[model samples]
Target: MIKQLPISVSGSRKYDVRSQFAALCYRIRKNKIQILLITSRGTRRWIVPKGWPMHGLTPAQTAAQEAWEEAGVRGQSDGRCLGIYSYSKETDENGHFPCLGMIFAVEVSSIADEYPEAGERERRWVSRKKAAKMVDEPELARILLDFDPRRPI
Candidate 1:
Protein backbone atom coordinates (compact mmCIF):
# COMPACT_ATOMS: atom_id res chain seq x y z
CA MET A 1 0.00 0.00 0.00
CA ILE A 2 1.15 3.56 -0.70
CA LYS A 3 1.61 5.72 2.35
CA GLN A 4 0.20 9.21 2.38
CA LEU A 5 2.95 11.57 3.39
CA PRO A 6 2.33 15.21 4.10
CA ILE A 7 3.10 17.54 1.23
CA SER A 8 5.39 20.41 2.06
CA VAL A 9 4.93 23.86 0.65
CA SER A 10 7.57 26.50 0.30
CA GLY A 11 5.84 29.86 0.34
CA SER A 12 3.52 29.77 -2.71
CA ARG A 13 4.93 26.53 -4.12
CA LYS A 14 3.43 23.19 -3.22
CA TYR A 15 5.48 20.06 -3.61
CA ASP A 16 3.46 17.13 -4.90
CA VAL A 17 5.29 14.00 -3.94
CA ARG A 18 4.18 10.94 -5.90
CA SER A 19 4.58 7.21 -5.32
CA GLN A 20 6.13 4.66 -7.69
CA PHE A 21 6.85 0.93 -7.61
CA ALA A 22 10.24 -0.60 -8.37
CA ALA A 23 11.44 -4.13 -9.01
CA LEU A 24 14.72 -5.25 -7.48
CA CYS A 25 15.31 -8.10 -9.84
CA TYR A 26 17.79 -10.77 -8.90
CA ARG A 27 18.79 -14.37 -9.48
CA ILE A 28 21.06 -16.99 -8.00
CA ARG A 29 23.92 -18.23 -10.18
CA LYS A 30 27.07 -20.09 -9.16
CA ASN A 31 25.82 -19.86 -5.56
CA LYS A 32 26.04 -16.06 -5.74
CA ILE A 33 23.34 -13.45 -5.87
CA GLN A 34 23.31 -11.34 -9.03
CA ILE A 35 21.28 -8.21 -9.50
CA LEU A 36 19.82 -6.97 -12.73
CA LEU A 37 20.28 -3.31 -13.53
CA ILE A 38 18.88 -1.46 -16.48
CA THR A 39 19.72 1.90 -17.98
CA SER A 40 17.11 4.58 -17.94
CA ARG A 41 15.87 5.50 -21.38
CA GLY A 42 16.39 9.22 -21.01
CA THR A 43 19.51 9.50 -18.85
CA ARG A 44 21.07 6.09 -19.51
CA ARG A 45 21.82 5.87 -15.80
CA TRP A 46 21.81 2.46 -14.18
CA ILE A 47 18.56 1.84 -12.29
CA VAL A 48 15.98 -0.80 -11.51
CA PRO A 49 12.72 -0.99 -13.39
CA LYS A 50 10.15 1.35 -11.84
CA GLY A 51 7.01 3.23 -12.78
CA TRP A 52 3.92 4.95 -11.44
CA PRO A 53 1.08 2.88 -9.94
CA MET A 54 -1.34 1.15 -12.24
CA HIS A 55 -5.10 0.94 -11.81
CA GLY A 56 -6.33 -2.27 -10.17
CA LEU A 57 -2.82 -3.53 -9.55
CA THR A 58 -1.02 -3.95 -6.26
CA PRO A 59 2.33 -2.29 -5.72
CA ALA A 60 4.23 -5.54 -6.22
CA GLN A 61 2.29 -6.32 -9.36
CA THR A 62 3.04 -2.89 -10.78
CA ALA A 63 6.70 -3.39 -10.02
CA ALA A 64 6.72 -6.70 -11.86
CA GLN A 65 5.01 -5.10 -14.82
CA GLU A 66 7.66 -2.40 -14.94
CA ALA A 67 10.38 -5.03 -14.85
CA TRP A 68 8.90 -6.79 -17.88
CA GLU A 69 8.44 -3.57 -19.79
CA GLU A 70 11.73 -1.90 -18.95
CA ALA A 71 14.16 -4.82 -18.75
CA GLY A 72 12.53 -7.82 -20.41
CA VAL A 73 12.35 -9.56 -17.08
CA ARG A 74 10.10 -12.53 -16.49
CA GLY A 75 9.91 -12.96 -12.76
CA GLN A 76 7.81 -13.34 -9.69
CA SER A 77 7.71 -10.74 -6.95
CA ASP A 78 7.92 -11.91 -3.37
CA GLY A 79 5.09 -9.50 -2.59
CA ARG A 80 7.02 -7.91 0.18
CA CYS A 81 8.37 -4.40 0.02
CA LEU A 82 12.10 -4.22 0.57
CA GLY A 83 12.01 -0.49 1.23
CA ILE A 84 11.18 2.93 -0.13
CA TYR A 85 13.60 5.37 -1.66
CA SER A 86 13.19 8.97 -2.65
CA TYR A 87 14.27 10.56 -5.93
CA SER A 88 13.48 13.47 -8.17
CA LYS A 89 11.80 12.55 -11.43
CA GLU A 90 12.52 14.79 -14.41
CA THR A 91 9.82 15.88 -16.77
CA ASP A 92 9.82 18.13 -19.77
CA GLU A 93 7.00 20.45 -18.82
CA ASN A 94 6.97 20.63 -15.01
CA GLY A 95 10.64 20.33 -14.25
CA HIS A 96 11.47 17.85 -11.47
CA PHE A 97 9.13 16.27 -8.94
CA PRO A 98 9.74 14.23 -5.82
CA CYS A 99 8.87 10.52 -5.95
CA LEU A 100 8.86 7.76 -3.38
CA GLY A 101 9.66 4.38 -4.94
CA MET A 102 8.62 1.26 -3.06
CA ILE A 103 10.91 -1.63 -3.96
CA PHE A 104 9.79 -5.25 -4.36
CA ALA A 105 12.13 -8.17 -4.76
CA VAL A 106 11.66 -10.17 -7.93
CA GLU A 107 13.33 -13.54 -8.33
CA VAL A 108 13.90 -13.63 -12.05
CA SER A 109 13.10 -16.85 -13.86
CA SER A 110 14.18 -15.72 -17.30
CA ILE A 111 14.77 -12.71 -19.52
CA ALA A 112 13.72 -12.27 -23.13
CA ASP A 113 15.59 -10.29 -25.77
CA GLU A 114 12.59 -8.71 -27.46
CA TYR A 115 10.64 -7.14 -24.63
CA PRO A 116 8.95 -3.76 -24.68
CA GLU A 117 11.97 -1.57 -24.03
CA ALA A 118 14.61 -3.71 -25.72
CA GLY A 119 15.63 -0.97 -28.12
CA GLU A 120 15.55 1.81 -25.57
CA ARG A 121 17.80 0.56 -22.77
CA GLU A 122 20.61 -1.76 -21.80
CA ARG A 123 20.57 -4.49 -19.18
CA ARG A 124 23.36 -5.92 -17.12
CA TRP A 125 23.84 -8.45 -14.36
CA VAL A 126 26.26 -7.59 -11.61
CA SER A 127 27.14 -8.28 -8.02
CA ARG A 128 24.93 -6.59 -5.44
CA LYS A 129 27.82 -4.51 -4.15
CA LYS A 130 28.61 -3.26 -7.64
CA ALA A 131 24.95 -2.44 -8.20
CA ALA A 132 24.88 -0.47 -4.97
CA LYS A 133 27.78 1.62 -6.16
CA MET A 134 26.32 2.02 -9.64
CA VAL A 135 23.10 3.68 -8.58
CA ASP A 136 22.95 7.36 -7.61
CA GLU A 137 20.29 7.02 -4.90
CA PRO A 138 21.88 6.52 -1.50
CA GLU A 139 18.90 4.79 0.09
CA LEU A 140 18.60 2.41 -2.83
CA ALA A 141 22.31 1.76 -2.67
CA ARG A 142 22.00 0.87 0.99
CA ILE A 143 19.11 -1.42 0.24
CA LEU A 144 21.16 -3.21 -2.36
CA LEU A 145 24.09 -3.50 0.02
CA ASP A 146 21.98 -4.96 2.81
CA PHE A 147 19.51 -7.08 0.86
CA ASP A 148 19.50 -10.82 1.55
CA PRO A 149 16.84 -12.77 -0.26
CA ARG A 150 17.32 -15.77 1.99
CA ARG A 151 16.30 -13.76 5.01
CA PRO A 152 12.57 -13.39 5.50
CA ILE A 153 11.19 -9.95 5.06
Candidate 2:
Protein backbone atom coordinates (compact mmCIF):
# COMPACT_ATOMS: atom_id res chain seq x y z
CA MET A 1 0.00 0.00 0.00
CA ILE A 2 1.25 3.50 -0.82
CA LYS A 3 1.36 5.73 2.22
CA GLN A 4 0.83 9.36 1.34
CA LEU A 5 1.98 12.24 3.46
CA PRO A 6 0.98 15.84 2.87
CA ILE A 7 4.04 17.90 2.12
CA SER A 8 4.14 21.66 1.82
CA VAL A 9 5.74 22.58 -1.51
CA SER A 10 5.52 26.37 -1.75
CA GLY A 11 3.68 28.39 0.90
CA SER A 12 0.22 26.86 1.45
CA ARG A 13 0.31 24.55 -1.57
CA LYS A 14 0.70 20.90 -0.60
CA TYR A 15 1.51 17.65 -2.39
CA ASP A 16 1.20 14.01 -1.52
CA VAL A 17 4.48 12.23 -0.90
CA ARG A 18 4.35 8.56 -1.75
CA SER A 19 6.68 5.87 -0.52
CA GLN A 20 9.03 3.65 -2.58
CA PHE A 21 11.61 0.98 -1.89
CA ALA A 22 15.10 0.87 -3.43
CA ALA A 23 18.01 -1.50 -3.46
CA LEU A 24 21.61 -0.43 -3.09
CA CYS A 25 23.11 -3.50 -4.69
CA TYR A 26 26.77 -4.00 -4.12
CA ARG A 27 29.61 -6.52 -4.24
CA ILE A 28 33.21 -6.64 -3.12
CA ARG A 29 35.82 -6.94 -5.83
CA LYS A 30 39.58 -6.84 -5.40
CA ASN A 31 39.15 -5.76 -1.77
CA LYS A 32 36.94 -2.83 -2.81
CA ILE A 33 33.19 -2.38 -2.88
CA GLN A 34 31.37 -1.82 -6.17
CA ILE A 35 27.83 -0.51 -6.44
CA LEU A 36 25.50 -1.71 -9.19
CA LEU A 37 23.59 0.98 -11.03
CA ILE A 38 20.95 0.69 -13.70
CA THR A 39 19.69 3.27 -16.19
CA SER A 40 16.16 4.54 -15.64
CA ARG A 41 13.84 3.31 -18.38
CA GLY A 42 12.39 6.68 -19.29
CA THR A 43 15.35 9.00 -18.95
CA ARG A 44 18.20 6.49 -19.11
CA ARG A 45 19.70 8.18 -16.09
CA TRP A 46 21.88 6.16 -13.76
CA ILE A 47 19.91 5.05 -10.70
CA VAL A 48 19.54 2.30 -8.19
CA PRO A 49 16.75 -0.24 -8.73
CA LYS A 50 13.55 0.96 -7.09
CA GLY A 51 9.79 0.42 -7.12
CA TRP A 52 6.51 0.94 -5.35
CA PRO A 53 5.68 -1.12 -2.26
CA MET A 54 4.48 -4.69 -2.79
CA HIS A 55 1.47 -6.07 -0.96
CA GLY A 56 2.97 -9.25 0.40
CA LEU A 57 6.54 -8.16 0.92
CA THR A 58 8.54 -6.15 3.38
CA PRO A 59 10.20 -2.97 2.18
CA ALA A 60 13.55 -4.68 1.97
CA GLN A 61 12.07 -7.58 0.02
CA THR A 62 10.47 -5.18 -2.43
CA ALA A 63 13.81 -3.50 -2.94
CA ALA A 64 15.50 -6.84 -3.58
CA GLN A 65 12.84 -7.84 -6.05
CA GLU A 66 13.25 -4.59 -7.93
CA ALA A 67 16.98 -5.16 -8.16
CA TRP A 68 16.44 -8.60 -9.66
CA GLU A 69 13.88 -7.38 -12.16
CA GLU A 70 15.65 -4.18 -13.14
CA ALA A 71 19.29 -5.21 -13.02
CA GLY A 72 19.33 -9.02 -12.98
CA VAL A 73 20.84 -8.88 -9.51
CA ARG A 74 20.90 -12.02 -7.38
CA GLY A 75 21.35 -10.80 -3.87
CA GLN A 76 20.36 -10.86 -0.22
CA SER A 77 19.14 -7.73 1.48
CA ASP A 78 20.43 -6.79 4.90
CA GLY A 79 16.78 -6.43 5.97
CA ARG A 80 17.37 -2.98 7.37
CA CYS A 81 16.79 0.37 5.74
CA LEU A 82 20.06 2.12 5.05
CA GLY A 83 18.49 5.51 4.44
CA ILE A 84 15.65 7.43 2.85
CA TYR A 85 15.90 9.68 -0.16
CA SER A 86 13.29 11.84 -1.80
CA TYR A 87 12.71 12.45 -5.50
CA SER A 88 10.14 13.66 -7.93
CA LYS A 89 8.67 10.83 -9.98
CA GLU A 90 7.59 11.73 -13.48
CA THR A 91 4.34 10.31 -14.64
CA ASP A 92 2.92 9.37 -18.01
CA GLU A 93 0.38 12.16 -17.76
CA ASN A 94 3.11 14.80 -18.05
CA GLY A 95 3.03 15.46 -14.32
CA HIS A 96 5.17 14.54 -11.35
CA PHE A 97 4.73 13.28 -7.82
CA PRO A 98 6.92 13.36 -4.73
CA CYS A 99 8.30 10.11 -3.41
CA LEU A 100 10.36 9.02 -0.43
CA GLY A 101 12.42 5.92 -1.17
CA MET A 102 13.67 3.67 1.60
CA ILE A 103 17.01 2.27 0.57
CA PHE A 104 18.03 -1.28 1.53
CA ALA A 105 21.48 -2.67 1.05
CA VAL A 106 21.68 -5.89 -0.95
CA GLU A 107 24.92 -7.83 -1.19
CA VAL A 108 24.96 -9.19 -4.73
CA SER A 109 25.87 -12.80 -5.34
CA SER A 110 25.74 -12.69 -9.13
CA ILE A 111 24.02 -11.12 -12.09
CA ALA A 112 22.14 -12.73 -14.95
CA ASP A 113 22.50 -11.89 -18.63
CA GLU A 114 18.74 -12.02 -19.16
CA TYR A 115 16.00 -10.86 -16.84
CA PRO A 116 12.97 -8.64 -16.69
CA GLU A 117 13.76 -5.21 -18.12
CA ALA A 118 16.96 -6.55 -19.70
CA GLY A 119 16.12 -4.85 -22.98
CA GLU A 120 14.91 -1.67 -21.33
CA ARG A 121 17.91 -0.73 -19.22
CA GLU A 122 21.67 -0.95 -19.00
CA ARG A 123 23.49 -1.99 -15.80
CA ARG A 124 26.94 -1.04 -14.65
CA TRP A 125 29.18 -1.73 -11.66
CA VAL A 126 31.04 1.28 -10.30
CA SER A 127 32.79 2.52 -7.20
CA ARG A 128 30.53 4.14 -4.63
CA LYS A 129 32.15 7.50 -5.28
CA LYS A 130 31.57 7.22 -9.02
CA ALA A 131 28.05 5.92 -8.52
CA ALA A 132 27.27 8.86 -6.24
CA LYS A 133 28.25 11.30 -8.97
CA MET A 134 26.36 9.38 -11.65
CA VAL A 135 22.97 9.61 -9.95
CA ASP A 136 21.02 12.86 -10.10
CA GLU A 137 19.45 12.72 -6.62
CA PRO A 138 21.54 14.55 -4.06
CA GLU A 139 20.22 12.62 -1.05
CA LEU A 140 20.77 9.32 -2.81
CA ALA A 141 24.26 10.44 -3.73
CA ARG A 142 25.02 11.27 -0.11
CA ILE A 143 23.77 7.85 0.95
CA LEU A 144 26.06 6.21 -1.59
CA LEU A 145 29.02 8.31 -0.49
CA ASP A 146 28.61 7.32 3.18
CA PHE A 147 27.52 3.70 2.81
CA ASP A 148 29.80 1.08 4.30
CA PRO A 149 28.54 -2.48 4.05
CA ARG A 150 31.05 -3.78 6.55
CA ARG A 151 29.50 -1.75 9.34
CA PRO A 152 26.39 -3.03 11.08
CA ILE A 153 23.27 -1.21 10.11
Candidate 3:
Protein backbone atom coordinates (compact mmCIF):
# COMPACT_ATOMS: atom_id res chain seq x y z
CA MET A 1 0.00 0.00 0.00
CA ILE A 2 1.19 3.52 -0.79
CA LYS A 3 1.39 5.90 2.13
CA GLN A 4 -0.53 9.12 2.03
CA LEU A 5 1.35 12.39 1.73
CA PRO A 6 0.40 16.02 1.33
CA ILE A 7 0.65 17.17 -2.27
CA SER A 8 0.87 20.67 -3.61
CA VAL A 9 -1.70 21.28 -6.32
CA SER A 10 -1.20 24.98 -6.92
CA GLY A 11 0.56 27.91 -5.27
CA SER A 12 0.03 27.85 -1.46
CA ARG A 13 -2.23 24.80 -1.60
CA LYS A 14 -1.34 21.45 -0.11
CA TYR A 15 -3.66 18.63 0.88
CA ASP A 16 -3.96 14.90 1.29
CA VAL A 17 -4.99 13.26 -1.98
CA ARG A 18 -8.10 11.34 -2.92
CA SER A 19 -8.23 8.39 -5.28
CA GLN A 20 -10.23 6.82 -8.05
CA PHE A 21 -11.01 3.17 -8.42
CA ALA A 22 -9.29 0.89 -10.93
CA ALA A 23 -9.91 -2.66 -11.99
CA LEU A 24 -6.82 -4.79 -12.29
CA CYS A 25 -8.42 -7.45 -14.43
CA TYR A 26 -6.49 -10.68 -14.69
CA ARG A 27 -6.94 -14.29 -15.74
CA ILE A 28 -5.02 -17.46 -15.11
CA ARG A 29 -4.37 -19.64 -18.10
CA LYS A 30 -2.09 -22.64 -18.32
CA ASN A 31 -0.47 -21.68 -15.06
CA LYS A 32 0.33 -18.20 -16.38
CA ILE A 33 -1.30 -14.93 -15.43
CA GLN A 34 -2.43 -12.45 -18.05
CA ILE A 35 -3.54 -8.90 -17.29
CA LEU A 36 -5.87 -6.74 -19.33
CA LEU A 37 -4.86 -3.21 -20.30
CA ILE A 38 -6.60 -0.49 -22.24
CA THR A 39 -5.36 2.57 -24.07
CA SER A 40 -6.20 5.88 -22.46
CA ARG A 41 -8.62 8.03 -24.45
CA GLY A 42 -6.31 11.03 -24.81
CA THR A 43 -2.66 10.04 -24.64
CA ARG A 44 -3.25 6.39 -25.57
CA ARG A 45 -1.03 5.21 -22.78
CA TRP A 46 -1.72 1.68 -21.55
CA ILE A 47 -3.53 1.53 -18.25
CA VAL A 48 -5.92 -0.51 -16.18
CA PRO A 49 -9.63 0.27 -16.50
CA LYS A 50 -10.36 3.12 -14.09
CA GLY A 51 -12.87 5.83 -13.39
CA TRP A 52 -14.28 8.26 -10.88
CA PRO A 53 -16.38 7.04 -8.00
CA MET A 54 -20.03 6.46 -8.64
CA HIS A 55 -22.91 6.87 -6.24
CA GLY A 56 -24.61 3.78 -4.78
CA LEU A 57 -21.67 1.48 -5.39
CA THR A 58 -18.66 0.49 -3.39
CA PRO A 59 -15.21 1.22 -4.71
CA ALA A 60 -14.55 -2.35 -5.81
CA GLN A 61 -17.93 -2.49 -7.50
CA THR A 62 -17.15 0.74 -9.25
CA ALA A 63 -13.92 -0.76 -10.48
CA ALA A 64 -15.87 -3.67 -11.95
CA GLN A 65 -18.19 -1.28 -13.73
CA GLU A 66 -15.23 0.57 -15.19
CA ALA A 67 -13.77 -2.71 -16.41
CA TRP A 68 -16.94 -3.57 -18.27
CA GLU A 69 -17.33 -0.13 -19.79
CA GLU A 70 -13.72 0.44 -20.78
CA ALA A 71 -12.59 -3.06 -21.68
CA GLY A 72 -15.76 -5.07 -22.28
CA VAL A 73 -14.85 -7.44 -19.52
CA ARG A 74 -16.61 -8.58 -16.34
CA GLY A 75 -15.55 -10.69 -13.46
CA GLN A 76 -15.79 -11.42 -9.78
CA SER A 77 -14.21 -8.84 -7.53
CA ASP A 78 -12.98 -10.07 -4.19
CA GLY A 79 -13.91 -6.71 -2.70
CA ARG A 80 -10.37 -6.24 -1.50
CA CYS A 81 -8.05 -3.53 -2.67
CA LEU A 82 -4.89 -4.90 -4.20
CA GLY A 83 -2.87 -1.74 -3.72
CA ILE A 84 -2.69 1.99 -4.22
CA TYR A 85 -0.59 3.95 -6.72
CA SER A 86 0.00 7.66 -6.98
CA TYR A 87 -0.01 9.51 -10.29
CA SER A 88 -0.46 12.99 -11.61
CA LYS A 89 -3.70 13.78 -13.45
CA GLU A 90 -3.61 16.61 -15.95
CA THR A 91 -6.68 18.77 -16.05
CA ASP A 92 -7.50 21.88 -17.94
CA GLU A 93 -8.71 23.76 -14.87
CA ASN A 94 -6.31 22.36 -12.29
CA GLY A 95 -3.28 21.98 -14.52
CA HIS A 96 -2.04 18.91 -12.71
CA PHE A 97 -3.08 17.28 -9.45
CA PRO A 98 -1.68 14.34 -7.58
CA CYS A 99 -4.18 11.48 -7.49
CA LEU A 100 -3.98 8.14 -5.81
CA GLY A 101 -5.53 5.18 -7.63
CA MET A 102 -6.82 2.23 -5.67
CA ILE A 103 -6.57 -0.98 -7.62
CA PHE A 104 -8.93 -3.89 -7.05
CA ALA A 105 -8.34 -7.35 -8.44
CA VAL A 106 -10.97 -8.63 -10.85
CA GLU A 107 -10.75 -12.22 -11.96
CA VAL A 108 -12.09 -11.93 -15.48
CA SER A 109 -14.83 -14.39 -16.36
CA SER A 110 -16.03 -12.94 -19.65
CA ILE A 111 -15.01 -10.63 -22.44
CA ALA A 112 -17.51 -9.06 -24.82
CA ASP A 113 -17.01 -7.97 -28.40
CA GLU A 114 -18.34 -4.54 -27.66
CA TYR A 115 -18.28 -2.21 -24.68
CA PRO A 116 -19.21 1.38 -23.86
CA GLU A 117 -15.81 2.67 -24.96
CA ALA A 118 -15.22 0.06 -27.64
CA GLY A 119 -14.82 2.59 -30.39
CA GLU A 120 -12.58 4.87 -28.38
CA ARG A 121 -10.20 2.45 -26.74
CA GLU A 122 -8.27 -0.67 -27.60
CA ARG A 123 -7.81 -3.47 -25.12
CA ARG A 124 -5.19 -6.16 -24.90
CA TRP A 125 -4.20 -8.98 -22.58
CA VAL A 126 -0.53 -9.50 -21.83
CA SER A 127 1.65 -11.29 -19.38
CA ARG A 128 1.83 -9.55 -16.01
CA LYS A 129 5.48 -8.62 -16.49
CA LYS A 130 4.79 -7.21 -19.95
CA ALA A 131 1.74 -5.33 -18.67
CA ALA A 132 3.87 -3.83 -15.93
CA LYS A 133 6.44 -2.66 -18.44
CA MET A 134 3.84 -1.32 -20.87
CA VAL A 135 2.38 1.16 -18.38
CA ASP A 136 4.21 4.45 -17.74
CA GLU A 137 3.44 4.82 -14.03
CA PRO A 138 6.20 3.47 -11.84
CA GLU A 139 3.93 2.77 -8.85
CA LEU A 140 1.35 1.00 -11.00
CA ALA A 141 4.06 -1.03 -12.69
CA ARG A 142 5.42 -2.01 -9.32
CA ILE A 143 1.98 -3.17 -8.19
CA LEU A 144 1.63 -5.37 -11.24
CA LEU A 145 5.11 -6.79 -10.85
CA ASP A 146 4.65 -7.62 -7.19
CA PHE A 147 1.00 -8.75 -7.20
CA ASP A 148 0.14 -11.29 -4.54
CA PRO A 149 -3.45 -12.11 -3.78
CA ARG A 150 -2.55 -13.99 -0.66
CA ARG A 151 -1.01 -11.00 0.99
CA PRO A 152 -2.94 -8.05 2.39
CA ILE A 153 -2.32 -4.67 0.83
User: Which one is best on lDDT?
Assistant: 1
lDDT of 3 by residue, 16-107 (tens): 33578899999988878899999999899999998777656778888999999999999978777778998878766677788999999998
Order the candidates by TM-score, highest first — what do you get? 1, 2, 3
lDDT of 2 by residue, 97-140 (tens): 88898999999998899998999999999999999999999999
Given candidate 2, what's the lDDT at residue 134?
Answer: 100
Q: How would you encode candidate 1's per-residue C-alpha lDDT over 9-85 as one tens digit per residue?
A: 23432234377889999999988899999999889999999987765677888899999999999898757789999
Estimate the TM-score for candidate 2. 0.87
Poorest stretch of ten by lDDT in candidate 3: 5-14
In model 3, where do residues sit more than 4 Å from their true spots? Answer: 1-17, 148-153
Of 2 and 3, the candidate ahead on lDDT is 2
Whole-model lDDT, candidate 3?
0.84
> For each candidate, what is the lDDT?
0.87, 0.87, 0.84
